[model samples]
Target: MTENRRFLLRRRPDGDPVRDDFELVSAPVPSPPPGGFVMRNHYCSIDPAMRGWMDDEPSYMPPIALDDPVRATTVGVVHASDNDDYAVGQWVMGLNAIEEYSVVTPGHFTAPVDVEAVDSPTRFLTAMGAVSLTAYFGMTDVAKPKAGETLCVTGAAGAVGSVVGQIGKIHGCRVIGIAGGAEKCRRLTEDYSFDVAIDYRGKDIEELRAEIAQAAPDGLDMVFENVGSPIMEAEVFNLATHARIVLCGLISEYNAEERVGLRNLWQLIVHQATIHGFLIADYAPRFPEGGAKIMEWVREGKLRIDEDVQEGIENSYDTFMRLFSGANEGKQILKLP
Candidate 1:
């Protein structure tokens, strides 16, 4: 008998999610109904945002239900289809959960993908994927950084922040990145080619503030925030006059019960700065325009991509923890059988 295995959400996590929080069970492979297609998942995304979806509370999207497959972006090739709009061999990406196969429709989260534009289809989940798209719209639309302006990115070695710093460079800004460790901080300057990098490994707030001030000596014109604890707290103090803080995420507080409070609201008022939180889904209407520009840069060698591809469906839990512990380099993805 053909069987499909899925990771079901067994419990809500405390500080960090463990393999015990989920259960993998076997089920019959689903057949696509009319106007639907079945996808054989190739690579599934392990994003920081997926951590937010497991809680039993309301937010941007509904929480994953108990005993249900966890939510995630799955890229795959369609193997069976009952719909004319989709072909059997077509490649697609969507919120297909952490499963080997998922039923999708045009109105669902699935979208057809073109893998020929970059080095590999995996780029569809990295450079040309939601990661880069989030960076593009966040910078161009929210931050609106200009040439000679200084932009600092937190979690700068991460999937979104890496793209954020690079895109800032492409737009003619002085880019600075803050990563957790020395190696990642080095990769930020050497690999992604950011102008400056600050290592927050064992540093305190004063140390981080001094580093930010030194790298961006003139103060920060924009902040592409990803981490939201001490990293964010220190950066907020260095904001230049009329600075724009695009709060893309708060990974530092995602797993905790009591969120780490930002104690520097006075800085925003003192500098007359603006802080706005944004979601990539909010800019869905402009995806084609955003995706096209990112791909153009990739093909022209103006933008770079780094991905940490881990194999196996059984390793999803450990693979996900890497993101929180700063163990994974670049975008984290898992290949399924």
Candidate 2:
């Protein structure tokens, strides 16, 4: 029997999660039945969404059970296969626990991965995985951004934020990104080709509003909000009439014990702005179509995908906490043994 090292939730997190909240333990890998396959995990994705999963609240996805292996998306190599569809030595992406190995019976959870075509295994966690798909559908299908319109994205240096801003550009919108620091702001504008980038760190609400106004003088036609709390409040005051705000992840409020109140909600009614909260799982059926278009843009050099890869699985807790602190420059993933 194969022995695997796995990270399990020792306790549900309050505020930001710490390494002690997770317990790394060894487990005997279960033998795959007739239809199952055994996989050796190579990399695991660490996303902001995982924080939401820790809460025992109603969400787009089910919360992870306490003491269970932490739920995550992973890229792995098939080591033993009883399922003809998944051959040994082939790479695959699946919703597996953070483990050295896993046994899975494929259904809604597993898909083949072409690692070479993707540039890196981590891309499956970022551009080609749920992150890119969220941006693709949220902007294209939900927000319906048009050319010449002004699009603003928050958490703009993150995995989903970067892709959302780029997709806005592809749709011919003047794209502006809101990031946390000078370095992230510089990368958003210089590397990702955002029309403007705002650094929100140390800035008061007035300063933030002023920078946003300067960047989008006519108001924002579309807003892809990844950070919530105070930033969302500021954006509300600057929304254009009939503006569509796609509410994706709320990184800001994740650390709060209680939900932060948005003081400017009346702005939504006054400006006729529509705020829609979405999870990528809702667009599961259309993933291929969206994924194909994103890949095409990537291949044509119209979209740039970025990733901040932590070197080892042992550092997963630190890497995950980086999302809330804005320490990660791109999609955060951990390379496993």
* Top-lDDT candidate index: 1
Segments of candidate 2 deviating more than 4 angstroms: none
Model 1 accuracy (lDDT, Cα): 0.88
Cα lDDT of all candidates, in order? Answer: 0.88, 0.86
Give one digit per residue, the lDDT tens place, for model 1 in 1-337.
2778787899998878888899888899899988899888899889999999998778989999888898888888997899987899999888878988887876646688987655677877886678889999999999998999999999999999988999899989999999887899899999898999898888899999998888877889999999897888899889999999999999989988899768888999999999988888877667779888987887888888789999987888888889989999889999896
Q: Which ten residues in a row have the lowest lDDT in candidate 1?
A: 101-110
Candidate 1 collision pairs: none
Residue 250 local lDDT, model 2: 80
**Backbone clashes counted, model 1:** 0
lDDT of 1 at 269: 94
What is the alpha-carbon lDDT of model 2 when measured against the actual structure? 0.86
